[model samples]
Target chain A: MNTTQTPCRELQVLSCRPGTEPTLVDLVLSPPGWTCRAGQFVMIRPLDWGSELVWPRPFSVCDVSDAGLRIFFQVVGRGTRKLAGLQPGQKVAVWGPLGRWFRIDENRPNLILAGGVGIAPFVMLARREKTDNLSMLFGHRLDLCHYPYAEIADRIESEAMRQTTAADIAAFETVLSGRIKTLSGIGQVLACGPEPMLKVVRRYCLMHGTEGQISLENRMACGVGACLGCVGRTVTGEYVQSCVHGPVFDVRDIDLGE
Target chain B: MDQTVQLGPLTLKNPVITASGTFGYGLEFMRYGDLTALGAICLKGISLAPREGNPTPRIAETPCGMLNAIGLQNVGVKKFLAEKLPYIPPGTTLIANLYAQTPEDFGELAAIFAAQERVAALEVNISCPNVREGGVQFGQDPAMAARVTSAVKKRAGSKPVMVKLSPNVTDVTVIARAAVDAGADMLSLINTLSGMSVDIRTRRSRLANIVGGLSGPAVKPVALRMVHQVTRAVQVPVIGMGGITSAEDVLEFILVGAHAVQVGTFNFMRPDNAFRLVEEVRTLAESLGISSWDEYRGTLRA
Candidate 1:
């Protein structure tokens, strides 16, 4: 397929879970474009009609292999609601390894904080991708509230076994204190999930002088830059759209209030 | 195929624009698509002073749609001209989408943006949710929509003032007629439907904000219906949008009386969808031997 000319391809739905429904679909792309980095996402469409659905729902690239990509998304709205209804082997459309990736510095001990499905990308980043000393702090509504943490644990275990070093990737499930203040430890933290959680994590990072990058979950249309729907204010007071400039950003740089 | 369209004094090479709130200042999406190729790019919604906007979970997805509660986050009028104006594409029509809590605020900001020579047109964004005015606000009410339209038009003077309407209204045509009566040069319909999603398992609102404006393909039929109705009710040209992903969709809107079409969420679906829409409209026109796509604009049958 032509790199720039060909439309981004949709792959078969390997699975679709209707509860907290995370619809996982694979997308096969050509050339260098297929490698969706950590904290990156792809725009997915459930059907073929061009503009039937007003917006393209963005899904976190939960996992990807050389064969294709995976998106972990909840069936929250009209788009996802339709997606959640799809059975396995059904076609799901997708576009791009869109937006910038989670910036990782292997030099520092990595601290991972995931809120619900926001943990999707971190799973990809943590597995096989070596970190100096990886410690993960995951917060959900409750222990079995939502998201695919068991799958994350499996990847971490498998990756650790391959490395021949059982450096425990510490995991936790703490109740939402209405604020993301419970997390601690590690020099650099990567957090994703709901807005409130990311905000608290960001504030904690700023106060403690710890470096952090947060994966922003904003409604996007193109998953590209055509629509300026996902603008996020920066700490520097500049408006940067979350879709183009990032799905991930330095936690301190984002203005979470608006 | 020629993409340019004459909007008042401005001549655009294309009819597809980055609708307000969808494309921030033109400088934001320079890397994603051909910035020069667009007919116009409306910056994020601007107000008299900086607005804090709404709270988070600002966005939530629906079937073929998503809801947004951004609340028009922007650097007020003065800052926009000083910081963002210089960065827009030179020849492209630069429309500043204006929002205000009151009619006076609209007039003040319109006057300010009109003063800047760089701004080609003023897109009065009356569709914003008014936090202060006891919620019986402009844009939702036809009379208030007209009031704000007249205020902006009077301040804008000779500059074309396009009023963007909200789909949350009961009768969009009534509001459209009010805007036209208030001297609007054009009207853009269907700026997100107010909707919400819930996490049934948790029994909570899906978005941090209780409600958000919905946009995407799911809203297309509703948008098209509004465009059709508004075009019949008012004389001003209507710019139709909602879930525009292809050139054929552009033709469909034009046939339904949309003078132009704005590609919103489609931009997120494919970075190049805007350019593709422009190219497809041209190819579609040529294929039909229409000579000009404008001839087909607003030619829809009742």
Candidate 2:
């Protein structure tokens, strides 16, 4: 439990890209010593804002490097709309390398599933894990939400885009079931997306007797455990904070049912 | 410059205390800044038994503030004493925020802390809006608020008792007067205002608990107004908090007669907020040519 309050630093934007969507922005921030696990997130706020935008927004760690770390986000609200407008060399206050990350087992095969901006966390996971042992399935309602990852595409088995439809879901299930059956050893499923998508993934893991972990996206004020805002129910009917206990949790442990 | 301020019998090194529930036992923040720099560390709300708290989506962000229904999820008082108390930096003032389903529960918790030397005071939380039980119920009524205050004071022994008052009432001063009359040594106001948010896309409530306490800069004016009114109504020292984030906000509360101010939701935005606030207060005080806070305390003109 390395739950230290992440120091606030002014991260200089190295580059900015008009990601897969017009509203989505890809930012490269160079803040020295900014390190995070595959499923971890950072709390970011614009320095130029007034009290109107007081709370910071949480974003999953998209990618990392010695030069800096990358974050991908959509301009869904006022806070992010302001973030998307930031240019290269601009600085934003960032506090992170926070929250629990995915538990990677190198020996086992990995099946990664992501939806829309949920693809953010897996970018780091893909970079860390051995590509040969990894398989990815990405779903999107529109092509604009698809992220272009040239680096890890050659090493890993990946499906860049599967339309989010009833027909595509069945096809995805068949493809996923076949992949699971063909793996030489025990494999795990890791997913992040909307609740409906996560529910489908949960059912697949339950039916196949495979272990899975899902990263949840709850609206949060403090990325730390102090606020008790991002709580989710465990299978045992007890509530655990999604920020501290997890942004990532074992599928078996999370009780998604209402 | 004199930074120390007296709150009843207790003398705080500074006037910046970390509001309860946001600081989380104070040890978790050691890496961000110096914990001892704060006037006091008001530990998260504690009860006689461990609480699991509300269901998922317990928090939601509003226009300028956020709604949280944490339900005072904390380990029991005994566990807090055993696991958390020893970790608090030596010589740091620890104000235990006590909550319960009834006045008797508050009495039991107060008695437990009354025996601990390190426990400086008890911020009896009869104003929490998240819990469905005795929190806001006791805070809303002046008589019940007095009863809870007296119950904790009776068992608190030598330790001072500060009654935390809620702003979700018709006249907060009436409740403040009641707590003061019931032997409350000091008062802290105003707890989060009751609020809720909804998701238009799903046509469902954003928080699983449906409603929660709203805290942040959004509630500052309301909190300041309540603190101002209560200070004029009661003789006990006042610790004001509602959306205090800056040095100016702290000064505004002091100008309205708050002996000290609590930093709450701002801690989430900046972990070292208390330290920064302490320095800001010092610099501001020095610039104003004031030797002590007493010169400016309650200096707000009509």
Candidate 3:
């Protein structure tokens, strides 16, 4: 576990862009001290928000640069709704680059599967890895524009998106399994999505004996491990705190019972 | 302003202490600020053996608070003492919060910390609402609360025993009196209030445990009333906590008769919040012409 973090700092919002899709947003804040690995995330909340929403929302760091700390997210609920209303120069409290990072198995062909807003972190992953061997399989219920495809578009070798209808899902699975079948014995599966989608990905990886890692979006009050509010069970029956042990876990390490 | 406050026989440099279960062994927040600056740091609840806690979806955010049914997932006492305890910085006061299924188990758990020189005090958690066994059961019954207090007090041996009281009870003062009568050196009042949240879409409970203890600013008023009741009902020094986010909240607890205050849910909003409050309280108090905890504690006119 990476205990290193940029302690909470009130950074001014540099820019807030409504995504191509209405609910989606690209929020950038100014902070030079923070850096993040592909899979790591930050806990953030608008400083003005008091008990209106006490707990800060956790978002995967989409990209970080001299420009600002970028986080692409969907305004799913009250927190994001409030976040969407932000204007430039408004400050939000943030602490991050917390949790473990993704370990790219350099030897293996990595297949990344992202669902809807789940594509946020992979933008950083795809940008950093720069591996021609990587491919992205994106699935979402909405149109292709709803997902932040452009941020990650030029980074990977190939990309595909499928609507979440049953037939479309089955087709997506066929294409994913076919790609894994082509790898023979040397492939890695990395995914972040709705639970049901990740469950399918985990099953595919487990069945094919390919190494897999899935980033879990567990609800956490405190981003630090103190709250114990974001625990997930492992294959061995041990409840691991997602905040500390991982927001990302190996498919075999966690048990998604049938 | 004088920041020091006496919590029973244990003297503290300041009134702000991070509550148990929220502070995570006291080492997790090292990135935020100095641990030695706070009065003390109470750790996660420890039992005789390791606990797996509840199932998934253990937390849900509410309007002003959150519901958590962590069920006390913790590394066991032996493991906590072995791996977790040694790493905490020296000069930082460490309070071992104990949780058990029975009075006998409570006494044995207390004895483990009582003999360790690193442990500064024992905070007995007789009130945890999420677990299926032990904690809340012992808390709801005065006899059981008294038994647990006496059992821990017998083995505590000069180390202060602060029995943390639950807010789920009909009359919190009844349990407060029972624990104080049984030999609690101090009392920390108002653990989370038991509550539930539902997802109307699925027609299912938000938390996997269905019900969980509620904490955050939402419970502040309830905590205030109970702390006032308990502080007046018992002679022991009282440490008050529940949804405390700022130095103002810390003073609110003190003004209502708390010897000291603990920062709980606010630690979630900002990792360095409790540390910030340690300084914020000084600034706030100095501006208000308050020089010491003695001048303000329990001075609530109502």
Clashes of each: 32, 1, 0
DockQ of 1: 0.29
| Model 2 TM | 0.94
After superposition, candidate 1 runs with Cα above 4 Å error: A1-30, A34-37, A44-108, A111-258, B1-4, B129-136, B140-143, B166-177, B196-209
| Model 1, position A242: C-alpha lDDT score | 87
Stretches off by above 4 angstroms in model 3 are A1-6
Compose the digit string of candidate 2's lDDT tens values, residues A1-258: 234544667788898787647676888888447567899988887666667766788989898788687998777887788888888888778877788888877777888777777878887777777657677777766673346444446557877656657897777667666654544248887888878778877776776778888998877777767777777888887878787788999988997883
True contacts kept of 3: 0.83
lDDT tens digits, residues B1-302, model 2?
98999987899999999999998998867767788778999999999999998776777777778888888888888899899889888988899999999999899999999999998999999999988889999999989999999999999999999999999999999999999999999999989999989988999888888988899999999999999999999888999999998888999999999999998988877666788889999998888888788888999998
Better of 2 and 3 by DockQ: 3
Model-by-model DockQ, in order: 0.29, 0.56, 0.76
Candidate 1 lDDT, tens digit per residue, A1-258?
455443456567665554542443223322223566787787766555444465566877777776446566654556666766667676656666778887777765666777655667876776657654565666554334355666666545321111112231112222222113333343577788788667767766766567778888876655665344566788876667788788888887889983
- The TM-score-based order of candidates, best leading, equals 3, 2, 1
Task: Quote the positional error of residue B83 for candidate 2 in Å.
Answer: 2.6
Cα-based TM-score, every candidate: 0.73, 0.94, 0.96
Candidate 3 per-residue lDDT over residues B124-238, each given as its tens digit: 9999999987888989999999999999999999899999999999999999999999999999978889999998899999988899999999999999999999988988899
Better of 2 and 3 by TM-score: 3
Residue B199, model 3: lDDT of: 84
Best by DockQ: 3
The order of the candidates by lDDT, greatest first, is 3, 2, 1
Native-referenced DockQ of model 3:
0.76
Per-prediction interface RMSD in Å: 4.3, 1.7, 1.2
Off by over 4 Å in 2: A1-6, A177-185
